[model samples]
Target chain A: MTRPALAQLVAVLVRPAAARELSLADWDLLVRVARVASLEGRLQATIEDAGMLPDVPPAPRRHLHAARVLADRQHAMVRWEVARIHEALAPEAIPVMLLKGAAYVMAGLPSAPGRQFSDVDILVPQARIQEAEQHLFVQGWVCEGYDAYDQRYYRQWMHELPPLTHMRRKSVLDVHHTILPPTARLHPDPALLWKAAVPLDGFPGMYVPGPADMVLHSATHLFHDGELENGLRDLADLDALLRHFAADDPHFWEHLTARSFEMDLARPLYYALRYGNELLQIPVPDSAFRALAVARPASPLRGLMDGLFRRGLKPHHWSCDGRLSGAARWLLYVRSHYLRMPLHLLAPHLMRKAIKDHRKAKREKSEP
Target chain B: MIAHEDLKARLRDAGLAIQVGPFVVRLRSQLDRIERSVALFYDRQLLPVDGAPFADFHVTLARSSGLRTVWRPQARFFLDGRSPFRPLPLAHAYPLFEWGLNWCIAQHAHDYLMVHAAVLERDGRALVMPGEPGSGKSTLTAALALSGWRLLSDEFALLSLETGKLVALPRPVSLKNAAIDLIRERHPRAIIGPASHDTSKGTVAHLKPPDSSIDRMHQQAGPAWLVFPRFSAGGSDRLQPLDRAEALLKLVGSSFNYSVVGGAGFEAAANLIEQSECLTLEYADLDASLGLLNAVAGGPA
Candidate 1:
């Protein structure tokens, strides 16, 4: 099959030098796809890192530059907010482990530059989660107006509290006690993660997960995520993290595989490795795959999941989608909820969401 | 460049790629009002889609689909297949397109430090008038463009971050409410489009940019003066010098992406203020305002 524009974007991301050969028309499509996937900044960073920005056509170069400027500004704001968050919780002595994007940025990881973030995610010990919330409340971060039912859902079943918005700055913060919901099928013990967390430089109370745990957390977050609008961007993060970590440590993959099994996150790691290798062509050791064999789904289910994820992982743009792409995304959304909670709880939650969405569409359509 | 009929056909089918100063926009619409608006306001900017291999923004102004099409029909604006705004009444299609295009530029064009202002150039120096709504900035811009100055833009002042120069993006000069008849009466030769009533901005029309302005849209000018214009009914025309510090703050406040661009935005705004004469103009009469502005531009009063 001929590579679609999305495949070309993936190729350019994997090998930034490939961008030199793209036609103006190709850049047009690539820019649209990358923007929709939220990977434009990442693409810009990779190309700039490769020192091939001058090789890009002027028309497309402006877009890359614009995205970079926005990302750089956001990175600065995130640093400031993280510092404020550290200050808020320092008195309580809460172990604030920066998760995902904030972690990548604070720790100065390869994936840090050019990543866009909507909120900061931090993990704390489950016992002190309320103490962390109380401290944040004193610092002027209030939970947004979620209805009673929604609040109950988050506080009871979800891993993170309802997102808190800073009154003055309007920035969002998500404080999680664990990587996954307490009720999730895959329970990665928070204790192991906390033990392995490393303190960020110049930040006494703040920490970032170690290299193996970081990769596992990213993989778990992506595979278990319900929304796939940024699926490709999240996968690129996994690819970047794996590539950087594996290259930095010779025995990285071995340690990651062992840790995934220990944390009961072997399945997400398997999917992350498979998709990263297949989609972006990130090099993965064959032994890693063999080690994850016990965590793979049954043959038929594996085939089905492959079909869904293959369609779901591309940019969520019309040009990148096939006939069943919509269905694949919907099925994965259901699968994500199922992974997060048991069927009894999942059914009601999805039904409520569907009803609310239907009402919203109706209201919009009826408006003049 | 393509003929009018070809532009309409392409707009109804694929899209019509038009050069709008520093950006290429692909506009697709089936509405007759949109076609007429483009013909009237952007006659010189249309480029053949095949020749223009890329577009910075792809927008569509279409009549709302389904039951709304028959009852209280609405026109929706979509940029790259996603609507950034709720649909307006079908009669307001042209204004919707204009507003949507402005949003596209303000949201994405971070390469330039954009301010909510009208800009015109005279003798290689730009006059930047930053104004809030009901401040008569657009009316003043229409007057200036009609007089002789090259219109840079009627809505945005795109300050290039790289050169610290004002880039021209001269499109239609939108005249709201009473300003519509005021311009038509003052400048009889000005080509103004049919007015759309009951818009969110109340009774809006567009004045076609002069051929001279569109012809030299690529020209970039250095900042010469920053004027904050306010319209006061029956008030005498007055121009007062504004402190550079206050001018910088107001300019930053009027900017669309000043905070997003951060330090560079501050530097660019400061440099523009530092190099230009900053003033506040409050006037009632168009002719008086024009004369005062001309004097500020160092031209005939």
Candidate 2:
């Protein structure tokens, strides 16, 4: 009864071989679990195996059907976006790289099939990011940034431009120069990422990170994320990427570990490897497992993180969210902020954000 | 299955699970008014096993926590255990629940192409009236439901993407402002709920479907007529045939999930247009309009 439904979802997904044997106690709880973990769409994609959903009854089947429809819609939408983004930036000739879900789709990886993308993320060379933004604006992808502070916040400190959305289509596009904010302690070299990028087959100007770098980016994005709203999904994506790249290259793990160190991202990678194996039951090479030990947070921090992450990463729902998970999420939220920027810059940013939220809330309340 | 008094008691005590359209919805609330309102509006609904699956949406209407409850006294809506929006006044809890259910369907239900329209059937053929606010869509639908037409839905016309048929989702028709009084006056026997004033959509109330419509809730209808009802105070009744291309364009605009449902939406919209003779209706006279709609549906005119 105390078993976390998130673990059960991941178990079914990553270890489908054992899924046929597992008896479901509450299909109702599992639906919430899948939604909270952002695995509803992924579950339908995962349940394509011949015997995957044989035990699931009708109610749960209905929920899964909705999820499948959503995934299909997202998949089609993502493809259309890539083509649109390509048309906008083609004249600039700036080597634009598709990131995350778009990259997964472009590469046709296992993770691509049912991945739901909120926004199209593209990496342009740092020097040309502004030029790329103007090109996009001309092509109708304009920023809806309402405030001076928000515009300044992104332009001054953040890694990406203010999110630009198509006027007609309304699909959001996030233009990024690097993975992390400039104000963060660890700013991965834009040149290094571009150097490792590989062009997509049919998309002429579009590219995706080389296999190892893609895994590293996924790990970095997940671990460093302020909110792990889709924590389980990201971990699942990493699991898929590791399994996928491992097929063609024996040294995929070796390169991933080395690249994490090279980019000063060993900390995130350590968490990714530990939780990826723990929650998802993904196979981690013994040598790679031992290699990450040096990179794990030292002693007291490691103990604190273990408790925080175990609760925080799981779905924040009645099925799994312990009373302590709320506190854990807050602590982790603060921890993410701490990692996002140095203390000098963090205070003002937090204050500005709080004020903006308060004013916005007031405006909404006053509306008829 | 729990009925009126028992369902209200259960909803007050624990929660109530009921089949709504193609999905099961479980709603929890401690408000006494919620119990009374639900009993009245959803009296005909079929209750499922308590705390069971097949619930596409789980919602709760509880008193807002903290000082706001002490001051203004509000009821907050929680969906899938998360409160997506802020609280509404306690008096408007019933209308809030109706709006919340509509939100649940509009947001999550993607298996069908959900059009923001009123749907009713007569003679095995469905009539779709896709309209914006102040278009007399719900009022016209309310009038028809009381007359002889089998009410499918007063909110959504759920077009099955696979079969191109309209699924019946019979629920109370939401009547706002003067229309509530109009419906009450016209249909004297209509099961109208109490009015909720000063909602986001102005004063609103729900009018329950007739017993006959409730009885045929499971019945499905084939697409036949699309009427875009436009209400005006002095406008004479008129029904002009709309071009297929323009009709499809208007339907796509009225659809809640046309963009998200993608190719399925396209196919369903195309199929609906092909099957139905579309029209733009401008009317002030109920009898005249009803006559026109009946004639178009090939029902007894």
Candidate 3:
């Protein structure tokens, strides 16, 4: 509960200028924690924005500078990949809605800088999803080797198709027809997102979700998704998105709150705003919290959820971990699956994964 | 600097922090083989700090846990409590540590434009020899390091991005296969570590770099020559001029983080080639190659 290193890391991230006052030893721990949390690039970007690069000590500066370089290169690659995706899908007249990191970067959002992600996620109409996949295949994007069960699980129950990797470039692209899985407890209509999508300038047939949808989708991906390894990074993304969008529009919070209720995603929105304010101290209006009162969990459950998320969201590093950090992360992982699917389907899927992992470990141990 | 006895004691208990060029690596090992190897090769660079508060890398060479310990004991290389490589045989602990350190630098140290080359310096000018495996690059590096040129690195040529200078990361030169015996014979005083056969790189041994190279580890040298060496069985000892543009492309292709560093990487490589005499050296013999390199360094042939 009392992680001084995590506290210091958060302080530096929220206000990078404070890095000027940090001791050499703090920089050492900060670099390690930031690297583990995948926030090194974000830290570098913020520090540079504050013009604190020259003031930082040489040893730590090299790491930050290196991360910035990597982030820039990754951003450029994402831009190029988006262009290629547009090229492949444009021929079919299918609209390519850029999602998450790729969307942030192409749309020139403030959340884009220093952000690195592995896959390019795109959304198309559910009716034309197959048609879009055909075009992508012709353009050298083939589905990665997912097992029969996983392939079936994705096609039948999941929102997105199994990830397609470009054969030559080795870049992954996730094609989705909706935001959440069909079996998930909440289904924010993909139609609403597509309707509100804004076209990207200079890129034909490519669009990014509207500001409210961007924040909602990021919040959903972070709080609803099973893997929280990059939990803190995703939270940071949410923080940046909210700050940027709120400043750009006078009624941004109102639009976000209304959209969350309109599309069955108020819970994630509520949690996002709550954590953004709690963890990163991003300002949220009292009216907005009052508006999402229906989505808030009961007092006892809410307290437990907060404890789990608070521990789960920190960088999964030993330096940042509490006594129950591992347990909290594991419980949240199970909770995510519970939210995504019915118990019958979830039980079998998890059991299969556990068995397969055990066999894999056994096989490895038997190797000479 | 810490004493050898102190270093060994620390290696067995907490860890021994040693300065390797620009980075401080804290090494720990319970195995006697690793302890002996560290005492032999890294005796000069051991810091007096009892467990350095801030290390660029924290690496451990420890015996692999589980059943492998009883039948075929193996050693694993861990960086920050996670092993990036599979466990090698217990006898191969020293070589594993060396390879592991190279992996750590190549993977994380994006501050510099890292080239897959051996670099040496003389008269304040660096000679970077970029070559593919089995090109006799390490063998040539060993020859030059013994013949008075201060060894910068045998694996990576750390090119500083801010300043177009070669930062010295002088460590033990890794010699493989026949080059081990070759270097041992050529330089009788050279302290070569115990060779571990059947490695992925074949038989591998590390030659302890001379004291002068370690002493001037902080010294940065302007890149004066870029030589791409290709070893042939009976090829002519020729040092022919290579086009700068072609050399730039080759350097980019041979770099570890060229694409990661992006535009800055391209500019750095181009600037290095532009400032240096770019050449392709093809030689069959070590002595003849050394003669040609010395001539290029403007030393007495």
Q: What is the interface RMSD of each candidate, in Å?
A: 0.9, 2.6, 1.5
Q: Least lDDT summed over 10 consecutive residues: which range in candidate 3 chain A?
A: A1-10
Compute the lDDT of residue A3 as modeled in candidate 3: 51
Rank by lDDT (best first): 1, 3, 2
Better of 1 and 2 by DockQ: 1
Cα misplacement distance, residue A27 of candidate 1 (Å): 0.5
Which numbered prediction scores highest in DockQ against the true structure?
1
TM-score, structure 2 vs. true: 0.94
How many steric clashes between backbone atoms does each model show? 0, 0, 0
Question: Which model scores highest in TM-score?
Answer: 1
Task: State each model's CA lDDT, in order.
Answer: 0.90, 0.83, 0.88
Q: List the residue pairs that clash in candidate 3.
A: none
TM-score for each predicted model, relative to the true structure: 0.98, 0.94, 0.96
lDDT tens readout by residue for model 1, A107-203: 9999988997778999989899999999999999999879898899999999999999999999999999998998899889999998998999998
**What does candidate 3's lDDT look like per residue over B172-244, in tens digits?**
8999999999888878999998988998899999999999999999999999999999988987899999988
Docking class of 3: medium
Off by over 4 Å in 1: A1-3, A358-368
